[model samples]
Target chain A: MRSNTRKYRLMILLCIAVTFFVFILSISIGRYSIPFWTVLQTLTLQESVDTTIRSVIFEIRLPRIIAAMLVGAALSVSGAAFQGLFKNPLVSSYHLGVSSGAGFGAALAILLAAGTFAIQLYAFTFGALAVAASFGLSRLVKGSSTLTLVLAGMVVSSFFSALISILEYVSNPLETLPLIVFWLMGSFNAIRIPDLINITPIILVGIAGVMLIRWRINILSMGEDEAQALGIDLKRIIGILVFCCTLSTAASVCIAGVIGWVGLVIPHIGRMFVGPDFKKLIPMSAIIGANYLLLMDDIARTLTTGEIPIGILTSLVGTPFFAVLLWRNKVGWS
Target chain B: MTFETRGLSFGYAKDRTIFENIGFSVGKGEIFCILGPNGTGKTSLLRCLSGISMPLTGSVTIDGKDLHSLSRAEVAKRLGFMPQLHSSIFPYTALEVAVMGRSPHLGIAASPSERDYDLAWKNLELLGISSLAEKPYTRISGGERQMVLLSMLLTQQPDIMLLDEPTSHLDFGNQVRLLELLRRFSKKGFSVVFTTHFPSHAFQLSCTVALMNKGTFESVGPAETQLTEENLRRIYGVDLCVEYVSKANSRTCVPIIKNDDGRGVGAR
Candidate 1:
């Protein structure tokens, strides 16, 4: 696979093409769909547009699309980071319990915050801080390895989740249980223009920061001992990466209510498409992830009268894809 | 560039001591092999000298500058290190893996320059591994990967090279080839330091030897002086022999493993 550089190049090209196609379809899809031409015209800033249609397309769809795109990219990049840091191909933020930490933060915001935008900020803040604290703790302890980090993450996540569950159990079910349930299932419906604005800075920083230090990340995948011999500051680089991934995870959770598998599935997809170089995989993972989630959200929204939780849909769709990957490995093609 | 660990001591943590009061120096153009058995802190000494771990006491100075004074990147720019072996899961290409050595020259957002690519390409070509430039590093044989790693170390263009058993996982031919490469590199004035169980490699190419028995250097001298039969026996704690043998009537000295009986096992 590494020999056939052309294969990765082609896979990347095809993914880009497919993602753009899906992005166009995602823009056109929703509760009162616009025509493809109208969508295109609006994008180009043409005149004589219907105000209601314009609001629906620009205000509702555009923000949702961006949120989907950012979350998708965030998950994949973070997933890749965790995998590289741990030096295990199977590691992800969710499995490391970063998701539960984030869920706790979001729940805390939901339970305590009074305003919508403030809650999103609070969730992102607490979420990123929680995982950062776990990493910090792991660093202080003696003889801490990746397994130790994972164990610490799980413990931290469990403690927070238990607190969240206690909060849920004590609250009025009629008022709060459905809110917690819907939040757990995950969604893109709650995001507004203001919410997107709140999430934009951190996502922007993470996306750009990851791309900037992308090669360092690739070197880091070699494991810290070798990387350190090669002159990398192992702890510092790992810290920055953990921060970026935490921020990315937090922002995504703030908007999407814990969308699963975008991080898990997209990186492998990007790797399959682009080999292991983060220079290529990072961006492709973001784009493909964004488009995948957006397309899935469109399907979830239109497939039934009742909205499907995005977390559920991702698990349903991604598990089979993950199996296909395992099967492909068995067949020796991938 | 010379490497020296003067009265150096190190531990994994505050209480765990691996080595103590170690002192040795490598010349600017020499292969100084650290010869010792396991649990003698061979790897720990290398780690301390390479600046990967701080010496609990004493100083490691490379090229007249103290190791602690130099930044990690600064030290890395002049020194290249290779551990035993690493097999990557991503299956990077030989060129790609080699190109990673250019990291010291890069900043946050910079791409590989033309010079960087040239260094990578030239190193691969120099190792006679130009054909593997496009091959997956994982797909290659263990010996080939070792060659690729040599190419990677060469790509760094360092004046000082530190290796922990560079030929441990390699085959006999690969061992010779790698030792030859290191010899050639030393001839170009790159100081090379390595630890190994094989003394013939040092006897063939290296100029000096640092023999350790406990937690410190017990003997340090010219290769012929420090790697003698008696010294090697004492260091390795085994009966051994190093003698010239004729292959097709040509004379060559080979280190032959001897049993306790201390007799040549076959025709020599």
Candidate 2:
């Protein structure tokens, strides 16, 4: 038992190291490439680095890199929590329709020619609203089982998705349509320091909340009657988890557009590394998710002169990897 | 501790009441066995006793405190419930699953400490299944899973243990072993309440038995008195004979099967 604890601790340390390595590597490889040493030097506040390199590091690459890490960790941890809370491996961070609602919000802001901040605010508010609607709809049922909540989420997701379709249908095809389409496809090309400043606390709080209550998730996954018998305040714990997940997920979508697959795939990978105990799985998912999105973002900017939207890359990369995991029959939950 | 319920009733809807106006109490160092046919609200009664589901029209009390007023943690500290069937989504190790019983004793944010794990391991060792500590609970046999769950209840250290059809899925030997464990625990001052389909189980323990037919218990008394051939026949609609077995030195109930023509099969 002691050795097993040691092994898990060592594995988590290794994952954190890998995440740091990826973070540094991502900062170094952009359009005007900076050397690894210069990137480190600039990060350490050394005066010997060139001003252009420092500006590029701090102004462009650093904010986007931080944004990538936050969004990735937020979505993945929320996904892991939701998967455990719902007791279904197929559930992702968007199980409550946050992404669809945020997509519609961003599309509406674009239709109104709103600025980036207004778009983000609208997206966050509507994303939270969508989950609230789902929860309220589920409460209208008799028992309000987990299945009912999931079905309600599906209903709300499709409703917002239809609203998005309507907005796309009526907009100017040449101007607003393309803008909305690109935003919906997802990108970090426009992430700036102020955007990071705006959403960082909410994201961090969400992640910290999940981290604090991760062990309870294992109890919660043991089914409703069992958990209640074990003395868990089912309503309170589930409410806290949903609130935290929604905060992080809504903040993630507001910033990064509808980035998919990271939440669904990264937790499975984490499980393969450390197994399904959420105490290990949650932090492991966060580290791996940050590394994954940073690498994907790096690929997005440097793959061609014209940047690829990261949502496209994530789906393109995540689908095959998920399929391989499934084909190998190692999706973790037995 | 004394676990008591008064005028308890439950149903999913207004018109479909499963059970009504039921009342019982089990004290320390006693075993209370509830015997009923299938779909007779046995599981529902256990759920109400464990505070997993509230009784529709009455109160369950633990040592004179109304169950509805106490917190869930407080109820769990006094009552440990082993469900009839557990299907875990994740493949947690047996030790991990057993350690979850410590949740009632720990704070909401706290995971099990080394001391808690030691208690769980001690219970597993007590049950003679310590080897299953690292094995995935989903991979173990049903009997072993029951032992693991029993070990979890032991680790919970509750005064009253409520189990719903605990022996329903077990083989013969496992069933005997589990009943033996419950008997031993009762002797050690734990109150045990379990529902089962087998009347022979009640005879084996020589415990207080409640024969439930439709919604309420038809009879509640000593197993020897309540589990008569006539009551068994009326409840189950099958002729059964309750007699003493000189070989096993205990009483047993044997159902008398008849042929299509109404004569007993293999009759002399």
Candidate 3:
């Protein structure tokens, strides 16, 4: 047990270091390709560095990097928490209809030619609305079982998905249609420093909430009766857990459009590295998720002259990598 | 602690009551067993006693405090319950499951500390399953999982324990081992109430045994008196032979073998 604890701690430290390394690496590898030393110098020297390099590092790359890290960490932590709460390893924020709702909201905003802030606001609102609809629908059923909630979420997701499609169909084909579609595909290309600053606290607060009640989250996964027997107030703790997961997932979707696969797979990877104890799993997932998305975003910027949509790249990379993780026996549902 | 229920009535729907007007009391250092047929509301009665559900027509009190009025954590601190064992979706280790027993003692945001871990480990030792600590609970045998659950209950340090069908899934040896453990807990001044489908188990534990039927306990008394062949037959609707074994110096209950058409061979 002592040795296992040490190994997990060491792995977590290594993951954090790697996240830092990847953050710096991602910032240096844009179209202009600043060297590592110059990137460091530009960050530290403030006003004294060369103007163009400083702008590229500070104005463009820095905000994007922060956005990628925050969105990744937020989605991954929410996914891990949701998986534990639902007691289903396959559960992710996407399945809760939040992402689909945000997608439609973003599509509608794009069709209306709303500004960036309005787009984010609409996305967050609709994402929240979608979960509310799902919850409400579940309650209307005779018995609001977890299975009922999941089914209701699917109904909401399909509804929002249809709404997004209708928005695309009605828009002017030349101008708004492609823009809406691209945004639906997801990217951090439009991320500004102010956007990053605005969403950071929400994501951090959400993450902290999950971390604070993480042990109870584990108990909740033990099933309703067992958790109740252990004196966990089922309604209160479950409410807090659902709120945190939805908050983080909505915030992530609002900022990054609708990046996929990170929330679903990163937690599984974390479970593989350490065991399923949420105390270690949540933090490990955050570190790994930050590194994974930072690297993917780096590829998004550097792969071709045009920026690859982050959503596409994640599925493209995530599928094969998930396969490899399974091949390597890292699927630690246990 | 004294556990008492007065005229308790409960059911899922208004018209269909599972059990009604039930009354019983148990004091410290007493082992009480409830025995009945499979669908006889045995588990439901235990659920009410454990405060998982409220009784409709009556009240359960723990040391004169209304059980329903106490906070969930407070109830858990005084009364630990073990439901029928189940496999969790996530494969948590036995140690992880055992440590969760400390939840009642913890704050909302608190995880188990080193002291809590020590307590959990101590209970696992008491159950004699300390070596299964690191094994994934899903990978362990059902009997081991049962022991692990008992360890978790022990870690709660409750004054009274309400266990539902505790021996349903255990092997023969594990069933005996678990009954011995329950006897030990009763001797240590912990009041225990468990529901069972086994009459022999009631006799083996030497506790207060209650025979439940359609709605309430048909008979409740010392195990030696309450576990008679007639009462067992009345509750189970099957003829039983409850006999004493002089060599083993204990009683065993078994169904009497019947020929075709549910009759004893000698009758034919």
Candidate 4:
């Protein structure tokens, strides 16, 4: 037992180290092509760096990198929590329709020629509203069983998706249509320091809240009756988890558009590393997720002169990886 | 703990009361067995007693304190409930599942400590299933799962244990072992309340037995007196004989089966 704890601790430390390395590498290899040593020197506040290099590192590359990491960590952790809470491995962070609602909100803002701030605000608000609608719908239909909530989420997701389709169809195809389409495809190219500042606290708080209550998630995965018998305040714990997951997932979508697959795939990878004990799985998912998204973002910007939207990249990368995981039969829900 | 229920009734809807105005009490170190036919609300009754479901009327109390007023943790600390069937999605180790019994004792944010793990291990060891500690709970057999759940409840260290049809899925030997363990725990001064379909189990324990039918207990008394041939016939709608087995020095229930020749086999 002691050795097992040690092994998990060592594995987590290794993941954190890899995340750190990925973070620095992502900052160094952007469009401006700063060297590794100069990136290191600028990060350390050295006197030898040029002003343009420092500003490029701080103002552009650093913010985008941080946003990618935060979004990745938030989505992945939320996904893991949702999977455990719902007791279904297929569930992702967006299972509650946050992404669809946020997509519609972003599309609406872009169609109106709103600034990034209004788009983000609209996205976050609607994302929360969508989940609230799902919850309310589930409550009205029956008691809050996981199956009912999942169905309600699907209903809301399709509803918002239809609304998005309507908005896309009515907008100017040449101007507003393309802008809305690009934003929905997702990217970190538009992320700035202010955007990072806006979302960092919410994401961090969400992550921290999940980490604190992660052990309870293991109890929840045991199923509702048993968990309640074990003395968990089921309503309170589930409420807290949904709120935290919604906060982080909505904040992630607000910045990164509808980046998919990180939440679904990363937690499975984390489980392969550590078993399904959420105490270990949650932190492991956060670190691996942060690294995975950062690497994806790096590929997005550098793969071509014309940047690929991260949503496209994540799907392209994540689908095959997920398939490989499935083919190997190592998703580990059994 | 002296656990009691007063006029407890439960139903899914206004017109459908599964059980109504039933009451009973269990003292320390006593074994109480609830025997009833299928669809007799045995599981629902256990749920109400465990506070998983609110009773439609009346109240359950532990040592004169109403159970509804206590927090879930406080209720859990005083009472442990083992469910009939557990379906696990993730492949958590048996030890991990066992350690979850410590949740009510821990703070909201706390995971089980090493001490808690030790207690869980001790319970598993006590149950003679320590070898299953590392096995994935989902991969283990049904009997082992029940034993693991029992170990988990033992780790909970509650004064009273409520189990819903605990022996229903066990093999014959596993059933005997489980009953023996319950008897041992009762000897050790823990009150045990379990629902089962087996009247023989009641005779084996020689404990308090309640035969429930329709929406109320048909009879609640010592196993020897309440588990008579006529009462068993009435509750089960089957012809059964209750007789002493000289070889085992215990009474057993045997259902009468008719041969193809219309001869009554072991009827009289």
lDDT of 2 at A180: 92
Interface RMSD score of each model: 4.2, 1.5, 2.0, 1.4
lDDT of each: 0.77, 0.91, 0.86, 0.91
Candidate 2 structure lDDT: 0.91
The DockQ leader among the candidates is 4
Model 1 in CAPRI terms: which quality?
Answer: acceptable
> Per-residue CA lDDT of candidate 1, range A1-334, in tens?
3234466568767877987778777888777888988888888888888888788878888888888888887888888767767766676656545666666666666677346666566667667767876887787787566667877787777877897798788766787667776877789886779888878888888777777778787687776666776778776777787777787788888778878877777788877766677767787778778788888888888899888999999999988998898778621111
- Model 4 residue pairs with clashes: none
**What TM-score number comes out for model 1?**
0.92
DockQ of candidates 1 onward, in order?
Answer: 0.38, 0.69, 0.61, 0.70
Model 2, residue B32: C-alpha shift (Å): 0.2
lDDT tens per residue, model 3, B1-268: 7899999999988689999888999999999999888787888898888887767789999998998788899999999999886778777789888988999999998888878888989988887888998888978987788889988999999999999888888888878888998898899999999998888888788789888889888878999999988888877788878999888678999787787888666543
Ten contiguous residues with the weakest lDDT in model 1 chain B: B244-253
User: Which 10 residues in a row give candidate 2 chain A its minimum summed lDDT?
Assistant: A1-10
Candidate 1 clashing pairs, residues 3+ apart or interchain? none
TM-score of every candidate relative to the true structure: 0.92, 0.97, 0.95, 0.97
Ranking by DockQ: 4, 2, 3, 1
lDDT of 4 by residue, B1-268 (tens): 7999999999989679999989999999999999988998999999999999989998999999999899999999989999998869999999999999998998988888878888999999988899999998989998899999989999888999999999988889889989999999999999999999888999999999999999899889999999999999998998778999989878999988878886677635
lDDT per residue for candidate 4 within A32-105, as digits (tens), equals 89888888899999998999999998999999999999999999999999999999988999999999999999
